[model samples]
Target: MESRSRRRSRSRNRERPYEITISTADMSSKMQTFIMEQVIECLNNRSHPKKMCRYIRERCNARYGPSWDCFVAREYYGSFAYVPRHLLGFELNGLNFLIFKGA
Candidate 1:
């Protein structure tokens, strides 16, 4: 059986056209679900903090394509006066911890 890494490498050149129409409600729910599941999976499966951060950041980039920075800024940066303290590994509560515990 081929490994996940091999599968990903094999698709490096596949240019998929962007044609999916997502409503605002659907996009919001889908992004939230995708983020939560990926974050949980990375936290549970990864053994290092940096690795987990990279995993999530990469997932965001892949999911949003060229607009990842815009999404991150809107979802995480622009709304806050400063970078969230939890992103620096402070003790946080509930889903906040799950979202921001890593680097």
Candidate 2:
């Protein structure tokens, strides 16, 4: 059974709007908007960063290709090597979203 506080917490999350800002994107603008939607929806359902990353990767892979990789974190750095026109970095609800396909 779920506690009342837990349920309320989830309800609050679902009610909040997620704002997305593109930090750096090598991909298309259409892809950026699509990813923003995916990220927001995933965030509504999942509370963990790893789960969010996997969710975004799976979505991208289904629509684009299987090489899709996603990193969801509050802070990220240290060299990202990805294919041309297949990398996007953004901020969604305060977390850094980095999606790319390996070269």
Best by TM-score: 2
lDDT of 2 by residue, 1-66 (tens): 111111111224466755456667787768766777777777777669888888888999999888
Candidate 1 global TM-score: 0.40
Candidate 2: 10-residue stretch with minimal lDDT: 1-10
Give me the candidate number with maximum lDDT.
Answer: 2
Tens digits of lDDT, candidate 1, 1-103: 1111110111123342212111122123456456545544644453355565567667766765422311211123223221222221111112222232222
Residue 18's lDDT in candidate 2: 54
Query: Against the hidden reference, what TM-scores do the models get?
Result: 0.40, 0.78
For each candidate, the alpha-carbon lDDT, in order, equals: 0.34, 0.73
Worst 10 residues of 1 by lDDT: 1-10
